[model samples]
Target: MKKFILILSVIFLIHTASAQLYIAPGADLRLAGNVQVTLQNTDLINDGAISVPATGRFIFNGNGNNQISGASVPYFSELEIAKTGTGLLTLANDIRVAGKILFTSNLIDMGNFYIDLGSTGYLDGEDENSRITATGTGEVLSTVTLNAPSGANPGNLGAVITSSQNLGSTVIQRGHQSQVNTHGTGSSILRYYDITPSNNTGLNATLRIYYFDAEKNNLDENTFELFKSDDNVNWTNVGQSARNTSMNYTEQTGLNSFSRWTLSNAAAALPVTGLKLSGQWKNGAAWLEWITQTEYHNSHFNVERKYEDDLNFFIVGRKNSAHPGGNSNTLTTYHWLDHPLSNKGPVQYRIQQQSLDGATAYSNIIAIRPDVNSQFIVSMYPTLHVKDGIYLKTGGLQVEKMHVRIVDMSGRLMMTREMNYQSGWLKLPQLAGGAYKVSIKSGDHHWEGSFVKD
Candidate 1:
């Protein structure tokens, strides 16, 4: 018995049904060396064994639609799709590319199958007009190992990741379908990325998600926000660090982990507009006022204040919205008088307008220097604590009783109690380890501070 090998090394043009390439069950076709094979206006039907060299180039180009249907999955070293007219390359079965997939003229529709770009494989020449798309539950996948990658775009899947720590083996899957959350309300663009890394925590990663304007799916690009989901159902707004509408990408930093990510508008759009803050030194206090030109679904307003030299802002007071239940087109004004116990330097203030669905927007900050006599001073000892209690010190003006309220970074009220005005330890409810804000209120006096819970 002798073995025969069918080798194709030229431009294979099969324009008619009789000229299509078909391999029987027992036939074996082996392509070796730097073979360049082009399938022009033809279908590849392979039911036998096919071997492709690592340096071979398989080009699919024609003026009509083509399909690759066979019993065995076709593995290619390099695949190129340069279709003309009303033509596209459709995958009838799963395909694996070891080198690269070049999209030049048309789209490759992965119908219920995958186009696996192996570890070293990637995509090139993909643009808004020519790219991979799918109408079914198909995806383009790539797996690569990264160690402190900088602008590393694996498989050209469009999710560029940068980090300072090793990401280990990372798997990136690109799907072209609008993603809906668990509640089935919000939707993303036509593309989404499900990225998983071996070292998914403490990465301090920065992710830049790229997309095409054509895939916006009727979304406003100006309001795009990066959303991440652990289960691909419940999504959280990770926030956009920067965005370039002309370049078609939204970036986010300070990510501790990686997961399913997509671009979508916020659950509830930020509904405050024309926010302006103004303050003045009135008598022996700082009189802060803010106004909103229009508000929708307005829940409340949080007055945040901080010293000019401080790094974090603390919520000093929260005011209920004038039109809490409905939209307001008229101007709404809010005011707060701050009586600081000590004036270290100039103070800055801003208004955080919160919506019913937890969406928030900030107003312009206004700074004011107070020229008042110090009446009382309050400070918290052991700003960073591991225990459930912290000490508070009050000096100068004496009061019999004072009210203390604690809120988290998101302005959620955590604890509130009435404490005696003295230097003593205050017990707190068990709180998760994070940063929190503390506000103390006495007759004609207000103080604000922050602490970290370990």
Candidate 2:
């Protein structure tokens, strides 16, 4: 154990030594006044963070994260940092640069370097001017214990990040890096990229915004503003975040913005989960038809019902879901029994769409006036306004021998035909060019419709 401890101490000393850079007699480092690095190697591996000798001024020139991986490059005794537009050094792997990690582009690959403030010693990445870019393959650990910044300590900030990785799996897991809005724009400026639903309907999303105020650790909350857009260009703020008050919020309402949820009603919501939202819908009373492009095995959507006078909703139904290992799936139609809805005047319904992972989404508001399918029937067979001479032959069910009657808007039967109980065609008699309704009926089967015989 003592040997191991000694080895660990030596390693720590080496790490500290790597950044104690100094300027050499003849070397060029750009950007900062001068940087002194000690190590220079072209064959460095990426197993862990490497160190650069901090000695003099030098410039690692290239665009974005560029590096010179060759043998014949001249070696500089002391390194330099240049501000030639974007003369930046990005560690493809972790690396250490002792001295001051200062530059016009105040971005330091945190995996490689740490700040050890000595007397008159201070490390800063903020010029309050340059933009910082954090790097990572999956999750980059840039552990930074900021001595904190002055002026605008912990301030609210907003960000809009897009994912176009080749792997197509850009998972922004929670605990990898800390975020702060050093910009201090403090007007609650909204910022976020757009996300369309699977069928371009609506997204079952979980909204999470992290903030680091006063330059301390990041702060989280349960409430946040949620918005959605049909096109990426235009957006509509769904509503204010109303979840975990202090640190989190979940859309316990099981909904984000849908095609028609906005402008519906403000009171139709539940307590927030953590300022985040998620949902998926599978079963309900009435059979609904729509296309779903993406599918998550998360919790299937809910079948919620609201009775007359009682503005509150209660879950009355549920449906199982498939596992979420694929990118997309579709459910042509979703049906619900809806026995929970009492015959009271106007009852409401909406799907509580949830993901297998607990994310939530919702459907459009659909209302049913008790016994609509039975009591308040609609006529279809001989629909008026249909083109002239268009024969009506009901295909699916037994329509051959049914009582078919055409009627005027004032409930006047102009023509009648006894359709056979099998497949047969119904020809209409010649009439003046006008509109009329058609009604078809059989034993216990009655249907009416409108038609246009021009």
Candidate 3:
């Protein structure tokens, strides 16, 4: 019962009259065809090997739940998938190839599978070389596994996994599931193997898994967790690794196996540890300040403010991040000022920290009630006067009562008066004037101006 079909070094053709071919599970077969294979079903448990010629096409109809548990033998020639149905093809086993593996199938289910590539192998869809594309309407989960050469603790490979959204271009990688909340329509999930650096061997000496949001931007490191699986059914938490926030990628320190890896839960994360943010008001302006005890690839800070009881905030100012005394461990201080807060009520403030790579975080929101008097603008005129008298003007949001006081440089009170008009004129007693300070107080609002009489 030796069930094997070897079409080696010969021109072999497989053209079924009914446009369909079915191979049983127990039939262990090997193929080296030079023609197109259409409408074929190699049922479950068929661990056959395929070796198509350079000009041949091994086409599979993606209609039913197809399974490919075969190797590409010595090399892969032209393997095509005609996406005629809506079902998925699960690569339950490894398919090591050194040639092209194209997919016409709209979707390839990989939530519990892997596409293990040879040391010099890569996957190519119709869009680009070294890319695996998804053209389906439903969500597609894809993961690529790479192992270090010679089974080293940490190795590298030259492989690229690229896919677009179901509609447009929203490329996502491991650890960015949070993006699906906003950009879920045209999105696909991509996962990769993480590797460390020891005896560097491959072209790209590092195996990195980039985590990006639905907007094609790198995701923050603190927003996700990493997990690994051996059987693809039961997964184990591998703990989140130290991320390169400025680069929006996490580098696995001591991983070398060919297991399935994933990045999940990409929601908003709190400010990094040892970060302190505060706000204050001075001279009719709101000032925001933050201090970080340590930093890593920190990019910039955005200051935002929200009106009373409003949950949404808008950016009002931005400050570039600077290291503390030329290093990252020292306490770094940053500040920004937002003058004339929009109509003076209870204003809330928060700082948004953005890393150079694309990671992001937010500080605790702080609220401050600005002085209602800030809405009133006070102005006074006249330096050297005798009869014209000094004019006092109070504009913007009229006040019921405003008290004015004139004091000498030596703290001697010269005159005090109260007015209710929006504009008024005051006559000060004749005095040997060198410098004097005029103070105006209206409710909780106070303003001070200076003048010198000759």
Candidate 4:
């Protein structure tokens, strides 16, 4: 028994000497100051909290395994898993860093942990700032945590992280990364991150992004794009982020699959100022009215609507913007009327602003329902004045034939036309500028409408 106890003591002492880590009960092992710790060809195990300061550097460079459990606070410093050997580091704790945490050519197993980029830290491929660049093909079973920046300097809030390897998940708290504002007078600001969402969650994987102006106090009305890519080079604008009013943060949720997300203010100076859309039931019709503040290189506005169960929005009306004031700083008011064939229970409406250069943006979505009884009815397009012909739809109702007539204000029939059940359009004869009445009849069904000829 004594011989066996001696052998066990020897083994414990050998491991204690080889590890070289300060082990304590309920105390953290810290690598502070300008300390440089290198794991050349062996595994390093730490059971207590591991704290590394900004001036400290931790390098893993061997074929052995390194495991850190309790908690790791690498505050605004550099940590590298070098390319020398097949090093595998398992971090089970929640790590908070403000500098670079890289995997040059090794592996890092996060074991479903969280890595918090507390103040500022990015993953790899950075030029002027610290980056988190992981070039290895290793697997990361970890989640990224991004806190909201509440400081005066917004540039220290957001992270510019990019990884060649796929990431598991990301959580963003409400925060601001303030870049100096040259708003209304300078080049637009842009920030983008490249990441590949693991197919483990399929395309239903969610990425939550919280955004606020880093330097500016109030959130400016700006445009942001969420882009996705299969190859890191080619990108597709998946969708736009929606502003969350309660949190005062632009929260972009519902990102299923992605290779990257890029947010930019292409037309930052062309502030939206104010945008509001409301619908009301008036004389069996739904009236939609909206107002816009500042507009630049504005082309037109498209009124779009969707039903409760529908996932797609259809353009219902169009209003040309004659920003007559030309890049006006004044408010512009617009209106549209929707005469639905059927009064649906719930319907959503929004305005799509198209720029002269074909770029487009959307206003906040508004949902409203008809106050009166809902039923299928025939409706027409271009209910307002038009220079060309008009389209009439039966709201998908069955009609043997359609008979249409146009008359002048004096009640004299100016023209008459007939259409089959599958017909779509009715051409009108040129008339002087005046209001006219249009009547359509099919068996017992009848619809009387009016329009102004331009």
Candidate 5:
């Protein structure tokens, strides 16, 4: 544990036995203005405070697979990654960059950690071969204030926005994971952008999304069209105003509000619309039913079910589309019964519509506690919001306490807590903006619901 304070401009280098420079807790490492600190073939473990002046630069370069991990996040004025060979920089915690992130060589694998760029920050030298990527749930976020901005790409996060009205404080988040829609999952490219503005309405805006060919995630770029989503669970096709295949970007205009956006195949449609799922207990069995407003080129519908403890959904049954070959403009209903239910706690169900073209889409999930009394009910309010907490209410049930568990879409447990309940507001953890499942259990009654953090 060593404390280093550099007030004078200097170049600091560390060559250690473990190839790691450790800044222990309570230690302070400060860089003077105009200082440049470079770590070559080394990793950084900073559990202490590290401060860099506005003009200081912190560079990580070498041929080693290095990592930055600690209880404390490192804030830098300028950060550079110039690793050679197959070496990459990985983040074990979130980091903030105020000046610039110079990506000269390989990639920065952000695994469940974020890279926050200040208002003046921007990415530099990022190309098809060298850029930021994520293997898990991580993102790169930038906040900037724009008034009638023209072709402004904040942090170069790849969503170039142009508008004739003031946007005020805007937040742009770039993630590497594919998005899920009313259809099952994996319906988008590896890149998606979540854009939020303080002044959201009445402003006609044009957005141009830029992407690297390597980030297509096996999708055909020629069919890419712009899609926008309010909850990231359901998407609406915002027709592409223009596109450049050679330049690898798509543009859309006439947008009044902004939210989650991504590119997907324009021809890839499930051919079914207004899908709804519901379930109830009937004659000692769980009766599930679904309705679709319109169907065209629909092949079949797969009924999928999962229990409270299940990590993945399994196809329980399949029903052929009412109009498999022809088109149906009227309503179509399908039903399935789960006899002799094994799990009495809680069960969730969804419908997957498969078209003749082999495309798929999903329906909203419905959960039911078959064993609970008819009068007992559990509900969560504001299922989608930008707030930090969600309220849960147990109606008709005198519940004193309950156990709650929150898990990400990947089934990774994010948090677990016990709270006194009847109706209460539960404070959520510092979760990244995405969809999460919350499970609550009290005695024999169990409930599962999902929410989106915008």
Candidate 6:
């Protein structure tokens, strides 16, 4: 409070003193070792210092609409800091600052900081504190200022830091990119085990399987599910991501693969190893498998199935208990039959591995067949297995002339050819190593999705 009074007193004295140079808008001014200002202009001044007297103050009043800039190459602010080591400058209203503000001292000491004030600007660094605070619905964005060493490592595509309330530590560094797809349409995931929990129960924890690329943004769209376990093997697909774009996951590509499963209870899993579930499913029953090559928490696990076509994986059957595991080397397996599937055409099947904490994990889809089915007979002839030019063929579909385009993951069109094939097969090209989209366009029928050349 005393400092504030003294600052105000100085302003009162400056307004009552005999000013040398008056700085208003559009006036030209100059200064050497010492010069005064009562009024000045908006344009810059040639190389010179406009220093006020040791006991006096320099007031730069732009009246809120003019600029007071400095001249000279890489020119600094005209009113430098600590000019006399005792002089002070009071600016009225908000002023724009450009260029480096040099302290000039071994270390700047004794100053105050203010904002939006021109007549009495804040004394910077006087409090020995500096901060970057945002106002008025403003957001402060974080960045990676450290650059990877060139040649040492040009760049890497993965999470540099990941933390949560699930595992032991709050940070984990993954790989080159689990998300890298032969065709860009596929998704990637990186799992962590260390986090800070909201409660003692593990079910309340978050599972952040993240992807940090323009290609990995789909994790934001797709549903994130928490597959549970007592033993790490045989996980059950328990829940979904609340923030998914398309909660109705008809299309797998847009689902939020980054899942943060909140365990409903507190279940210790320090003894488990095989903690992941494969999403691939078949017929009415999807696959539920875990690779608990290590174990500690030796709880029994069950495979449950659900159908989004109607309801979720109602309980199907339960599996028995397993050995409390360790990470050294242990692998476990548990499988069960799924029941009450969608009677309609094709119903989705997902395995939810449940833990004591009420945590869950949904296995990949295993398209279940109703006892009878037709194999895709999907024979890519002349055999796409070989590098020989790969092409799309719908000549037998009785479809008319159409345009089929193949695009790489980055959404770049790779191969596009007009197809007039009315009978057997459509000629295509064997694309470079990676994923491609074979989109068939005919009138209103347009198809686009992910495809692998091999």
Each model's total of backbone clashes:
0, 88, 3, 13, 4, 94
lDDT of 1 by residue, 166-268 (tens): 9999999998988864334456788999999999989999999999988888888888888777877655666799999999999999999988888977534
Candidate 5 — which pairs collide? 182-362, 183-361, 183-362, 184-362
lDDT of 2 by residue, 51-168 (tens): 2343443343323333322122223323333334444444433332233334444233323222222222222343333322333321221121122112111111111121121112
lDDT of 5 by residue, 218-331 (tens): 888887888777877655667688989899999999999999999876445336666788988776577998988656577898989887557999998899987738357567
Best by lDDT: 5
lDDT of 1: 0.80
Q: On residues 86-205, what C-alpha lDDT tens digit does candidate 3 reach at each position? A: 655555444434444566654444333334443333344433121232222212222223232222221122222221111111121222122121111111134333332222232222
Off by over 4 Å in 2: 1-189, 193-388, 395-400
User: Residue 435, candidate 6: how far off, in angstroms?
Assistant: 39
Candidate 5 accuracy as lDDT: 0.81
What are the Cα lDDT values of the candidates? 0.80, 0.36, 0.49, 0.52, 0.81, 0.34
Error of 4 at 428 (Å): 47
**Would you list the clashing residue pairs of candidate 3?**
165-186, 175-263, 246-357
Select the stronger candidate by TM-score from 1 and 2. Answer: 1
lDDT of 6: 0.34
Q: Give the lowest summed-lDDT range of ten residues in model 6.
A: 149-158
| Candidate 5: RMSD to truth | 15.3
- Model 4, 1-454: lDDT tens per residue? 5334533443454355354333334554455589776655434444445566877776766666665554333333666766345456665454555676665665555554545554365445322222221222212112353232122112222423322233344433211122221122212223334343333233333343433343222324345434343543323334444644344233344444455444434343343435567777677677888877555566788999887546799999999885752255456788898886453345688988776777666777887655433422345667677667887655445556778889989998889988775537777797788888887777665667778878
RMSD of 6: 20.1
Off by over 4 Å in 4: 1-34, 39-47, 51-276, 292-296, 305-314, 322-332, 341-348, 361-454
